[model samples]
Target: MSKKIETDNTCNTSRRNLMKGTGLAVAAMSMIPAATATQAFAQTSEWDKVFPKSDKVDHQKVPFNNRYGITLIADLYLPKNRSGQPLAALAVGGPFGAVKEQSSGLYAQTMAERGFAALAFDPSFTGESGGKPRNVASPDINTEDFSAAVDYLGLQPYIDRQRIGVIGICGWGGMALNAVAVDKRVKAVVATTMYDMTRVMSKGYNDSVTPEQRGEALEQLSHQRWADAEKNMPAYQPPYNELKGGEPQFLVDYHDYYMTPRGYHPRAVNSGNAWTQTTPLSFMNMPILTYIAEISPRPLLLIHGENAHSRYFSETAFAAAAEPKELMIIPNASHTDLYDRMDKIPFDRIADFFGQHLA
Candidate 1:
C-alpha cells in the first residue's frame, strides 16, 4: 500500500493556478438523445475495433468537442439489459498513442456489460478525431479531452450526470487524474498501467536523464521548430513500434501489441504512424501531476501489474495523492497484460469501486 498524504492547501492553490489556462466550456447542457447524437456525427456502422464486439453492450460512434473546439470521436457502450433507469457512466481513454479501437474500447465494453454506460474516445489530433496538424500531442489539450468526454456523457439522456466517473489507461492515466483534480464533476477515477507522460518526457525514463542531457534534448526540439517552420509542416519520425533488434523488453511488449495481429489497427499511431518532431515540447515543462493531491475527497483506484515497468509511476502517484485511494497490483503481470487480459485486468474490483462511489 502506498502511504496516504494529508491534504495541503498549497496543493489546492497550485491546482487552481493550473486550471486557469485549461478551462473548458461545455458546448451544450440540454439532453442529447441517442438518435440525435448519432445523426449529428457521421458514424460507421461496421465494427472496426481491434477487439471483437461484445453481444452484451450496444455500441455506436459519437463526437464531442473540447474547450479548444477540437472535436473528439468516441465509441459509446451501453448495457443491452438496461432496467430503464438513469445509469452511472464512465468516460474512458488511452494507453496514449493508441486509439479507441484498442484497449480503451475493450475496457468500455466490459464496463458496460457490468451495468454502467462507458465511452472510449480518441484524444484530439489522433485516430478519427478532428484536429489539424495531425499526430501532435498536448498535455493541456489532452487533459481537457477527458473533461470534454465527461461533458458529452453528462448530456446523454440515459446517463446520470452526477454519477459520472473516468477511467484512463497508460499515459492518459496521468491526464485523467489532472482532469479530475480540477473538474470535480467526476465522482471517481481509475487509472490502469499508468504512465506519467509529462514526467517521462521531461526527465526521461526512470529520471535517468541528467540536467545537461535535458537541456540538449530541449535544444534539439527547439531547433526542429525552425525546420518545421521552413517546411510549413512538422516533420514526423519514422513509423512507430518497429522492432529493429535488441530493443528493451518494454519496447518489445509494445511492438507485440501494436505491430502484430493481436492489437494492430491502421489508425493507431502506435500501430504504424508517428507523432510530430516537436510533440514533446509541450509536455516537457508541463507537469500534469503537480496537484494530484487535490483529488483527495474523490476516491481514486490505481491498478498496475506487479512486474510492469510503469508500476513506479502509479506507486509514486499513489503516495502523492491524499486519502481515499488504493493501489492494486496484479501478481506476475506485465503492463500490457492489463490492457486486454481479462483475467489480470481486475474488472470486478473496478466495477465495485465505481459501484460504491457512483451509487
Candidate 2:
C-alpha cells in the first residue's frame, strides 16, 4: 500500500489537495458550502456508462455549474415522445462514491420513460465531473450539488421550473433532503437505500462508536493530514479487493455489484479505488441534515430494502423529517440490491410519488 502511494504520487496529490487549492487550506476550505474556485472536467462524448442505453429515452451528456462553482457532468434523459408542454424534471445522484452511470442513471432513465425530464449527475469531485484532488468528499459541497441540479432544471425552457424534484440514493439520499431544506425550489424528494455519511463516519454504524472513539478517529485523521502535508499528497487507502476471499456479506454484495459487469463503471470509486483517507476530515465535524425538519410541507419519500443494513438511515431520516413524508421498505432487498436490481427497486412507486407531488 505504501509502495502504491509512493509510486502514484501524481494522482495521489489529487486525493485531497486539488479540491481545496492548497494543502494547508483543505480542512477549512472544504467546509464552506459554496466555493469561488473553478475546475476543468475531462468531458467525454463516448457512451461508456455501466448501464445499457435506453431506447425509451433520448439521452445527452450535459454540464452544469454548482453553487460551489464546480462544473458537474450529468446524463439528461427525456422521453423520446415528449408532449413538450412544460414537464416536471428530476435530478438524481449518489450511493456515496458512485458515479452517475450506475443506479442514478437507471433511476433517471426510468423516470424519463414515465414522462418526466431526468438528470443523473456526478457529484463535485467524483466521476467525469470537475474538481481536482481526484477523490474528496464534503458534506457541504455535496449538498450544494443537488441544488445546482435544481437550478439547472429550473432554467430549461421545456421544464416547469417550479416542479423540480430530486432523488438521492444511499448517502446522497440524505443529501437530497439537505438540499430541500435550503432550496424550496425542490417541491418533492425521494431517498432510496440511504446512508447519512456523516452520521456513520462520526458515530460508526448503528451509532455504536463512543465520543472517545470518535476523538481517536479524528486524531488519526489529523495525523493523516500531517502526512498529507509532508508528502504533499493526501493519505490513501486502497479499496477492498473485489475478488478477495472471506469478506463480510455486505462487502461481498458490494463486490458483486460495483466490481463486475453487473454494475461496474470505469469512473466509480467503489469499482476500483476508495475515497481519499483524509476526506473523512470534513464529515467528522459537519453534521448534515440537522435541519431536516425544515423540509416539511414539501413532500419526501424514503425507500429502503427491508433487509438492508443501512435501513436505519432512512428510518431515522424519516422520523426527523416533518409532515408530507412517507417511508417504504422493500421486502427482501439488500443495500446493494437496489443499485441495479430494476425488478426490486419499485420504480412504479417512485413514478407515482414524483408524478403526484411533482404535479
The Cα local distance difference test for each model comes to 0.82, 0.78
RMSD of candidate 1 to the truth, in angstroms, is: 10.6
**Candidate 1 Cα misplacement greater than 4 A, ranges:** 1-43
Q: Give per-residue CA lDDT, model 1, range 135-224, as digits (tens).
A: 778999999999999999999889999999999999999999999999999999999999998887876666655677677777877877
Off by over 4 Å in 2: 1-41, 241-243
lDDT, residue 29, model 2 = 23
Number of the top-ranking candidate, with TM-score as the measure? 1
**Could you tell me the TM-score of candidate 1?**
0.88
RMSD to native for every prediction?
Answer: 10.6, 11.3
For candidate 2, the clash count comes to 2
